[model samples]
Target: MIKTNTKKICIVVSSLGVGGAERSSALLSEMLFDLDFDVHIVSVLDKIDYPYKGKLLNLGKLKAEDDSKMGRFKRLKIFKNYLKAHKFDYVIDNRTRIGLFKELIVSKWIYNAKNTIYCVRSYNTDMYIYPSKFFAKLLYGSAYKIVSVSKAIAEKLNNEFGFKNLEVIHNQVAIDAEELLVKKTIKDNYILFFGRLNDDIKNISLLLEAYSKSKLPHNSVKLKILGNGKDKMMLKQKSDTLGLSNHVEFLEFLVNPYPFVEAAFFTVLTSRFEGFPRALVESLSVGTPVISVDCKSGPNEIIVNEKNGLLVENHNIEALTNAMNRMLEDKNLYLQCKSNAQKSIEKFSKSTIGQQWKTILK
Candidate 1:
């Protein structure tokens, strides 16, 4: 059902998997579709797991990799032809464009500045691993606009790249209190931690240590760790070593984790760094208060200390433990925070974030 008068938009990303950036792109595409825009997705890897709107253009199918040196160029040619044929009003690129040569070629020649919007999801330093700072500065300095998901990210990008057209458009998630209330969930009470089991980034070990030290376990409170990864065994072993094998449980990733989220007393995130932690927002959306480490980019922006959740110092196990104890002992504060959670996150609603995209794209 394409509208004759609608403007066509193409969202470009590495893949539409379960990552934060992928989810953001999917949510934005859905919202834009609702607003009568014809949306299209360009996934480099052809890996799409998120629900989205519009046609999908998988450049990876070009088998460019099978061709070696000239494959990427051939794929780019095919993509260019598609863009020319569709005459897309805008191409919002959400992929990390840190590979200077390829990204510069794609951003500069494949897509013109006026028709493309570059997105920066992570902190400035983490955006690209290769090339020098000067190269990153030059690469994004030429875009029509650079979109950052959080103010902290935006500031870091500005301080480093100083892009002339950097814009802050926070990532969004849907929040429906009535709907969440109706969803069937487990009757057991537990504190939840959901997301990848990556210890280096997610720091599940920190969470385990904090929980083991907290007084909640003494009160028969269970800590449930959800999501799967390579570090699952190591984290489980750590839990065992800490004598929390009985109290801390490790669970596999669930497609619909909202029911578990709803059933929790509260949720916790102990990430080393984040683009924008969707877990915190999702937890708050379902009326479950959160306690997160005030990490590099996301937690501080979302969690108002003692308001909707508590923000502990980054990498401080003692502080994290204290925060968990506080949430358990301070019943009045926890109730107040839970009561205010849903209303506080309304600004991040689909409609609001969609409107921001509309303004930026226009």
Candidate 2:
């Protein structure tokens, strides 16, 4: 038996604002606290709007003190100082890149943490294509265990980088099916495309095009978008140019947006990448069927392709249109997936996966 009295853990991150890593850390902190571990967070970034009520030590946002350059030795020293002062049993780093928050300094200085775990929330394979992959690899050994949010992430770590010592612990989430089935005042005919609208990586531009051609009646078929990012204005402008102004609705960020999850017929995700969308899993928990592009890993693992959800060819709008249409027109297929949607998410429920993390901490 593990010693319940001996439990002490620390989760370190740039900030607990709005991101997958923050959400995961928040949920896991709550779960670990329930299990009686003395949990605390070390926020290395400016004010963490810490949603979780656990103890948060605000280290008064460190100043780089040296340079305005994107990466310079001055900023690195500030991060190095933060790690030296605060100590813990284990350190869980959530920053995805090496240089973003001076995370490398923490890992290198606090190398004595009994267990240092890094949470990988993005597709590890494409790190090379995106900025910072090569640098992140350099900091790999500063941690004892790497917690990958999905198998694709883990495989990328192993296959591409030849790194070992990994574990797969999906995010834990749940939703109420009865609550999710409520019809909005708006008609049921509208399809939805939610997520960071501005990011080209989500292929929202393609989604707008495919949706424009959809037989989903222009009057009845509106696309509701949620979340904000750098490309928000650009996407909205593109929607106007495509003559799809009436078809798309942009919603500002929400503090508690589960109703959006409940209101839609199904959640739509067209990301060029994902670790495992915690939002998709939560939507499925509420019995919402999803039509997602077959991204590298997350969708295929959770969605059974016409079983619990519909998986379409990645980056192809025609295929996305056909799949979306099938969900709308084919009542039998829709019902088949609807019936399985809530049930398919059993593996990622709090009892199952949350306990898995508890096991890790213990």
Candidate 3:
């Protein structure tokens, strides 16, 4: 049974599907609900896949039904009405705020600034605060709080925008008890890279290059790249060109990728930048050590070099290749990392992060 509470909170998100930030929002809703707050979710998009605990206001469904300009106005009116009706104690805005005019209207006319919290979930600040830095400051200046998912993001915002109300909260992972208990059997020896297949940000090409150079291919270890994106075909072609057609395997995104992570030799990340890389943390939580390029704002915080996992310098193809080779050849080092993996990420557990949110909400 859910306990009742007077402090009502609403989470506004772009979608609750297929992305790290969206997953975090879904987890936040469940956390707030479990913390006895009357949690409500307002997903702007209609792609709800993750399990969440809250009353939903799916504006995307409404948009899908009526996509006309008039329909947009109607949705806006409905959104304003819903906020007015609920009188929520706090509204956490987790959507990308790139449209300056649209955000200005929403901030000035719709949302109550003093009770609203804005979240910045990417290293690319332009996605969350666009047009101009001065405008972003003016826009979010009076917000109850501006929460950055990593300390690097928070520091960047502070340095660039001089915003005083900033908080750093790392994304939490939902470690399943059943998953932990299940005995994972490795069917094949493959290194894994899961998440969006975007090349611009994820830098998957770098991963492919590093994998091709690594000694794992000679040892008959395959490279499994999972998830879908616009660059899927391109990445596949690159794999073929690298003569890795037989060695590299592409799998579609899975709702629960824990089994894949658990069964892998280890997971690898080669992103250029990240707000907080969930794949690395998720991999570690399942007792799988990871090899990641020490990208901006995330990997340094999560990985201890040669401890829980290997953290190579960003964009260094040779360094990553060497790390991968070491992980495969160094049995003692790999075992040590695997043993430390699950315990290293205990700070990112749901309950620990939930308590942090509870304090922020209060």
lDDT of candidate model 1 versus the reference: 0.82
lDDT per residue, candidate 2, 1-362, as tens digits? Answer: 24364556777666776665567777777777766776777665654543664567544344333235644454455444644555556667665554434444555554553477878787844431123446555566445778888898888777766656688998887443444455446555455655555464677887787778777644376788877778889989988998878778888865355667666777788888888887688777767788888987788888898898888898898998888788888989988988898789898887898678777776
Q: Write the per-residue lDDT of candidate 1 for residues 1-362, one digit (tens) a residue.
A: 95764689998888887576777788777888888898998888766777788889987666645656688778888888888899998888888765668877886678977777888777635664223667665665666888888889888876765667888888888744454655764666699999878888899889888888899899999999988888999988999999998898888776567888988999999988887888999999889999999887888888889999998898999999999998899999999889988877888888888789889767
Top candidate when judged by lDDT against the true structure: 3
Model 2 segments more than 4 A misplaced: 1-5, 47-50, 59-87, 100-104, 124-138, 175-189
Among all candidates shown, the one with the greatest TM-score: 3
Per-candidate Cα RMSD to the true structure, in Å, reads 2.3, 4.2, 1.5
What candidate 3 gets wrong by more than 4 Å, as runs, is 179-186
- Model 3 lDDT tens row, 82-102: 999999999999999868888
Over 4 Å off, model 1: 61-67, 128-133, 175-185
Using lDDT as the measure, what is the rank order of every candidate, best first? Answer: 3, 1, 2
